[model samples]
Target: MASYSGNIDYLAPNGVKMLKGIDNDNPERVYICTPLDVNEIKLERHPQDPNRMVAKMRVNICPLSENYKNVVRRSAQERGNANVSVPTHEMQMSFSVGYIKSVAQKFPKLVEQVKEANKERDPEIMGQDPTDENTHLFKAIRQRMNKRLAMLYQPQPPQQPSPYATPNVGVAGAATGYVAPAEGTDPLAGFTDADVGDLPF
Candidate 1:
């Protein structure tokens, strides 16, 4: 008989379904994980709005701190499953394209890592046009250029706005924010982390 390792459901405060992204309640929690695979990043159309685009990727993270490990264990135990082992490896994380870009800008090394991974996965990627956003490999080049530019110019602190100033409201893109689907929606909903191992992340 084939053994079954069942899905472990991790809950946030108030039993809200915690799927792919980092737990909002524990913003400081840290995890150890490998670099993203070459096929990890993907461009997809937004589920709620057809005109918009969102990049959906899966991130496998393992709790790095002992306290966090215990928390994961406790969460599993609270689910009434003594047999279910704490998932110390391959916890799912989600990121929007904008967040990814921000990370790249802050940590320029990440852009190089992506490029190296792409070349390792397919040598042809090295020859692809860097400006093309249609392919994942070239997208990394674009991100790399952006990272370089960001490094060239350090950001200045934002100025306080006047009380009488009209706030600017911009349309949403994969450009900013953590989640993309909608409020209270999980990008990784309806699928276990194992299910999306080959999908994204």
Candidate 2:
């Protein structure tokens, strides 16, 4: 019930390919990769299509890992209540635009911030009881737009030097486990060999 003609500004000149498959002996595909920065991406209502929208990528920032394929199969016993099962791939064939606008795109950062906030989770400032909904751990998850990312991420303990790591040494030193003497230390203090070398008359 609408009319329009021309290039849609909301579509990238070269849109991203989010999926690939075979159709009619020719390769077929879909375009729906997540933009790194939402502010750089634009979604505009289509002119002729009332129910459709155009997503344009203002810049290219897609990473390699997001384009790979992973398949998963869950057995009925693992699923807890299912008698039927099918393997699911990494990307969904059909995606809801409204849900994309409201939830999916906003989810990754939400989890990141919650993880960041959980790093600062103190039972004293929040609550001591694990069941208490007033805790920062519980509250941060509910607050979707929480900017608690300023909280420090969990720090990993420093890795100790590997016990099996090879030490630098000459061939003989390696076999004998000879450590280089430190500065100001005698190098030949432990030598028990005869120092008189062919000096007999």
TM-scores, one per candidate: 0.24, 0.18
Model 2 clashing-pair count: 0
Q: Give the per-residue lDDT digits (tens) of candidate 1, residues 121-181.
A: 7777765544344667646644333211010111334558657433232322222343434
lDDT of 2 by residue, 1-201 (tens): 322122122222222224333223434433233332222234567889977768543321111232231111244446574433231111111212332233222344443444555666543433332223555544444333221111111233445765644323221111122233355543223322243121110
Note the Cα lDDT for every prediction shown: 0.42, 0.32
Worst 10 contiguous positions by lDDT, candidate 1: 145-154
> RMSD (Cα, Å) of candidate 1?
19.6
Candidate 2 local accuracy as lDDT? 0.32
Counting clashing residue pairs in each candidate, in order, gives: 2, 0
